[model samples]
Target: MTPDNFIQNQKQQSSTPYPYPYPPPFSGPQPVHFSQYTPPVADSSILSHIMHSISSIDSRLSKLESMDKKLDKFDGLCEAVDSLFTRVKTSESDVKKTHYSISNIKLDELNAEKDNLWIAQASGGSGSPGKGSKLKKEIAEIHKQNSELKSTVSDLNLVIRPSLAHGCAVWLPSSASSQQIL
Candidate 1:
């Protein structure tokens, strides 16, 4: 038979009623049966849903990346803190060395000052009163001689008053004026 006739015959057989009185008619489409017909989906809404999911995932990925950067910065800070701790430890040693040097210098100065004090005491003759009294007498005698000379100069000043070249007048007591003129 011809292809068209064969197709028509198959259609007629399929459309014919079955002998069973209770069976329902095949209510679906004629079984053209090529590829399966999935009803066309409302793809725009689905596409939007898929894009939203992707955007949410992307946002999460960005947050993770930001957290990673913050962790890196924290690690850098920890390294800096370790370096500072090392410097502080080194400074402690330096401080110890400086303290040692200062103590040595202080001890040497103390010894030198002690020696100076001893020398001063020794020169004052075992801290005796007689040596101190003798020194005082000599100092007093020297001051008395200085006063006598000042009196002589003041007397000479009175005599030479007219002959002397004057810058400014300095007052001299009559007792001490002798040394003033000379």
Candidate 2:
């Protein structure tokens, strides 16, 4: 039989009322079937529905790709913030250590000055008053310097806190040390 006759016979069989109903037409991309290829003429509404579905899927895929790119950017920003946080912590530690050492040194100096004052006052030795006076002056100067150092450190800590928290400033160890002008 010719190809046309065969196709016509197939159409007739599909139209007949059989015990089992025929499968509905494909609304998606047509699949290649048999040696003789023929495009299935589907309903226009089915064609529109298929086209709309394909476009909707394409749009969703593009949106997912865009979200992935944004996620990468957000991850990079988080890493940068985390590194800055580490640096700020290190800087605060350094500041605290320096303050502690200075406090210890000041305490030692004050103790020594107390001893000198006591020794000068105990004995009626020559130049005793002069030595005591000098020691007092030195002690006073050390106290003044200590207070100033504390103030400076407090100011630096305050400044560093906001700058680091805001993520606008990145503190390298070397640079942070240099900026600690106390």
Candidate 3:
């Protein structure tokens, strides 16, 4: 016979009630031979086989449920990370506003410094007004703290970058849109 005909004959003989990736549908009462006369399959053997199949199906279903639960937990964690990023951004904005207002106050103090020279001289050549000096120190401290916070937030982005990349992969098989991360 030609190869095509032989292959077609093989296909016809291999009967299955379900599509690929699914188990073939179970047929009832398969005959088993133990002697020349061909005795029927023992009841105990049939019961054991059925039990084994049922156990396998149950385990697979249980594993599927466990995976679903883990995905839910991962989703919740991603939301929490997104919220934390939002809070950090809000705090950064607040700090920026405070820094701007403080800078304005320092500018006013600088303008007033020329006028305060007489007071400084009156106090035995101290050369600096007490209140102006105090304001300068405060402004310097604020600038230092703001710079530190900015650097910290920038560092946090470094850590978040790789985590977000991996998390997107776990949540979506296809490439996710850019808006999803933000």
On lDDT, the candidate that comes out on top is: 2
Tell me the spans in candidate 1 whose CA falls farther than 4 Å from its real position.
1-42, 125-182
CA deviation > 4 Å runs, candidate 2: 1-37, 124-182
- lDDT string, candidate 2, 149-180, tens digits: 78767767877787777767534343235533
lDDT (CA) per prediction: 0.76, 0.77, 0.73
lDDT of 3 by residue, 21-40 (tens): 47774487554542335655
Per-candidate Cα RMSD to the true structure, in Å, reads: 16.7, 32.6, 40.3
* TM-score leaderboard ranking: 2, 1, 3
Count of clashes, each model: 9, 0, 0
Native-referenced Cα lDDT, model 3: 0.73
Q: Write the per-residue lDDT of candidate 1 for residues 37-121, one digit (tens) a residue.
A: 5656678989999999999999999999999999999999999999999999999999999999999999999999888765655
Query: Where does model 3 exceed 4 Å of error?
Result: 1-46, 118-182
In the predicted model 1, the residue pairs found to clash are 150-179, 151-178, 152-178, 153-178, 153-179, 154-177, 154-178, 154-179, 155-178
**What lDDT score is found at residue 68 in candidate 2?**
100
Colliding pairs, model 3 = none
